[model samples]
Target: MEKLIDCHFHIWDLDANYYPWLTDNVSENVTKITGDYSSIRRNYLVEDFRKDIGDLNVVAAVHVQADADPKDSVKETQWLQSVADGSGNGMPQGIVARGALNADNAEEIIEAHCACPNMRGMRVEMHPGLNAPADYNPLKDEKWLRNFALLQKHDLVFEVRAASPEQTKDVIQLMRDHPETNFVFPHLALSIWRDEEAIAAWKRNIKIFGELPNAYIKLSGYGLFGLGWTTEMVRPYVMDVIDAMGPDQVVCGSNYPVDSMAAPYSRIWETHFQLLDDAGITGADRAKILHDNGKRVYKL
Candidate 1:
């Protein structure tokens, strides 16, 4: 069994914290990216994650915000830290809590989130929509930029979630603007794998981040390609990122429960391992993607 760090799994207690995505008119407000997400709308606790992971030696894990209501943002971090303390295994050693960068309380919210011992970073989704203009993102707003600078001050990582080409362009510029801040691009920058033109743009945009010393991308959420996706079907998109970013700049994550809508938790890892094997990513370089880079990037 290989030891790994799942840099992007999520755990949520629907009764304890209100996640709009899970509690709201779930069918009507379902994520368009994953289509119908009816399968994972239940409460997914740390124990559920342990059972799903089975025998895989997940040495440590990072819990990304589970789209909890912004009012409960800091509360979510505190809740996760409590989970870590009480779960016996300290499963989630790091957390990327939600921070609304453009809000009036942005700095205050970030400060509270950082106060949590498990907090390693914060995520403010920059991808407004697939067709939204690049400038439509918060990255264009001075207030958001000002709040984002706080990450550098506190030595916290910024998890970038831009999906569109327009959004990707804006994020690239944002990375250049904040050269001192560390940015982790999760979900392969939310690739649109079925589209060739999109892949081309993704390949081109990823190179810019790959060149920057402060940027890293997480190889998770292949389930975005749809539930029936095969290893070969997803190869070009995964390889394009690895090719541009290099294995050293890439990190692995399960993006679970959300991705469980597409495939089993164990199968997700198997697919990633196969992707790495077919790419001939072996030994130290392979370990960096599967384990080491996560430890360094998440500060675990």
Candidate 2:
């Protein structure tokens, strides 16, 4: 009996002419999205994802927003729904569609995504990178906050993606200001580092974000930023996150296709699971971190 609910992953078809982010020109322009994304630039439907999991016993999955063009965000939701419907067993029972928080028609885009039967919440990629807009100050902007209020009105979770340590600070403050909206922080609070000072700051900030009762952390998306695929490569960070966020607010995620850039599905999941075991996480508490917490957080 496989009993895991992967909280983050993606499925896209570049041939479908939908995802601008995966298009040739876009990939060329934003080369730093990862060290090398060429290996995953092809189509990856639900079946491919299922193949990757290979006996991991994934009962359900939650598809997080991929960086398709903003106009096609709702289309991505629709595509995932079709994939689930085709699968008959609901591979992605929940869909987190991308919505540009500062866009003029942000409400319309959110509504369009919410209209989909499987849509669960919205994600705005303010990861602060070369791909990120130079002028966008999501943490302090009026447009960003005003648009975020819409999530409160519609009862949607706001999935935050903080790519760097500086961005992590911004996400922490966002959660503090909007305690009403349930938040999902993916990528280990976006804290991947090598320097001692950086690790210390990230740990300190993790504690700050973890204390807030309004959010949950999805531990996924490793190896994408030059990190290796060994258990030792991730063990310290995994234990650190578990200690800070606690099992109740920490959920396991695969971050597939994107994480595929670093390692295969089995490798990442194995690494994550082993870390939990090494940290003495077992029984219902372990189940909560692996699957049960994802069900509760995403309302699966």
lDDT of each: 0.83, 0.78
Model 1 has an lDDT value of 0.83
For model 1 the TM-score comes to 0.93
- Evaluated at residue 48, the lDDT of candidate 1 is 95
The residue ranges of model 1 lying beyond 4 angstroms of the native Cα positions read: 27-29, 130-136, 191-194
Model 2's alpha-carbon lDDT is 0.78
User: TM-score per candidate, in order?
Assistant: 0.93, 0.91
- Model 2 deviation from native, Cα RMSD in Å: 2.1
Candidate 2, run of 10 with poorest lDDT: 24-33
Per-residue lDDT of candidate 2, residues 94-132 (tens digit): 898886888899899888888877788888767555356
Which digits, one per residue and each the tens of the lDDT, describe model 1 over residues 1-300?
A: 778999999999998898877887864424667888877888999999999989998999999988787677888898898899997278689999887877888778888888878889988766655323445668678888888888888788988765556567777777898998889988887554437787677777878888998899888888877778788877887888888889879999999889888788899899889999988899999999999999998899
